[model samples]
Target: MFDNFKKNSERYRDYEVIAKFIRLAIPARWRPIGYLEHLVRSRTGGRIPKGPFAGMRYIHTAFGSAYVPKLLGIYERELNPFIEQACALNCPLIVDVGAAEGYYAIGMALRNPDARVIAFEMEQKGRAALKEMAELNNVTSRVEIRARCKRPDLAQILATSDRALILCDAEGDEETLLDPETIPMLAHTHLLVEVHEFVSAGIAERVMKRFAATHKIRRIWQEDRHRSDLPFATLGTTLLPRFYLDWSVSEWRPERMSWLWMEPRTVNAPAA
Candidate 1:
């Protein structure tokens, strides 16, 4: 009873109230406006102008414009190091859990031609966008799109490859799915998992403890540098809603999201 009361109390906190209000204010049909902006930016052509994955093509979804900095490859400072290490190892396969719209999956495929990417997303819109992006990037041949993935499925997939990398953003599901004892193959695979402590408290510590024996776990928090420089202020006078206008001004990130990057102790580091 007390736990329930505490949870309910947390829900009405100041930040929570603001967040709820923002969600209510945002129009259900945000796609049209986002697509119109995409047209203006000509971002659908999907060329990343700079960064390690430059020259890669990714079809921006209607809502993709909200994360313009991430699409342009400057959102997360911690992401690049793992990407670089993964590329250097040249793992044969990459398993992307919760691969929303094929951003990291397609981008990683573009970065390493020899590696195959298996992207898993359950939502219809996300699947459609991922397919289009993969096709646009000419990576359809190398990228496989899956509607959903389970831990056993992941174990099976990883068992087939000698060396593989797992990039997981499975909301709060990582707690259950990433347990090394249950999924023994995880001990051998390189992993970058988004720890959702915000959704399920103590999950980060639990996940860390699970992999401590065989893997070197590094926790990286979200990067705060959003693309504030975008001309949203000038465009605000136009038709865009106040929700988007306010959201655009800040770097898009959760209050607390940390990534657990795990490298197998047995796996030799690639030569510099």
Candidate 2:
């Protein structure tokens, strides 16, 4: 709840930021993005039409903008390559923090049948939705649902696996949970974390520095949704306007967002 607020004063708030606040304050199904969601559901029948998670069904992803974009298969499209790479690894274990409604958790579980996904969603609604999503996709056996992932809980989870893929978006808790000095097991784990700089400042730089010694780090910035990124061919048909198309695909971010992909420098987990 607290992590969602950007803390910028009204006197100098960016218009996009203001829009984001307004969007959050209202019911998600209200307008603009909601309108687009209605159109897409009518077209795609509530399943994700394309992208890596094609054929995946959903109840809701909790957040707005996520609905239509996920259906279109371009939600956080910048991470496509990394997501594919994770699939190739067929990572034995995947830890998803802030697993809001199981987007990546369920999707990855679906893609990598051998993998077990431990999803940690603190919110009751999110946890319930994630559980439902797992059932909906019939991956309930593979996707383990959990609550908050504290440092000790994370350590225990990481220790349970030889190699795991950590997909996280802890809002501002990255600083606390991703600490290598505390959780040395991270040295052997691959991580893709959304650095919520909108609320947690300088966290991106700090995370990079922390992992520079033990991991190969690559930073990815969020990209605007484009018509080309959409799968019109996959969807088969749509006669939407240019504005609607743009709005439907947009992530509707207040400011730019980024993700850090960290691959371990060595295969072996370092000694504690």
Cα lDDT of model 1 by residue, 1-272, tens digit: 13333333343354445656655777633453343345324642556666677776655443232455555555455688877887888988899999878778888998889988999997878888888988888898999899878888888888778888999989899988887788877878899998887799999999899899999989886644322434433443256544443344333444545798899988644335
Off by over 4 Å in 1: 1-36, 43-45, 62-65, 226-246, 249-251, 268-272
Q: Over 4 Å off in model 2, which ranges?
A: 1-32, 227-245, 269-272
lDDT of 2 by residue, 155-241 (tens): 999888888999999988988899989998899889999998888789999999999999999999876555555544333225444
Reference-based TM-score of each model: 0.77, 0.82
Top candidate, metric lDDT: 2
Against the reference, the lDDT scores of all candidates come to 0.71, 0.79
Highest TM-score against the true fold, candidate: 2
Q: Least accurate stretch of 10 residues (summed lDDT) in model 2?
A: 3-12
Q: What is the C-alpha RMSD of each candidate to the true structure, in Å?
A: 6.3, 6.1
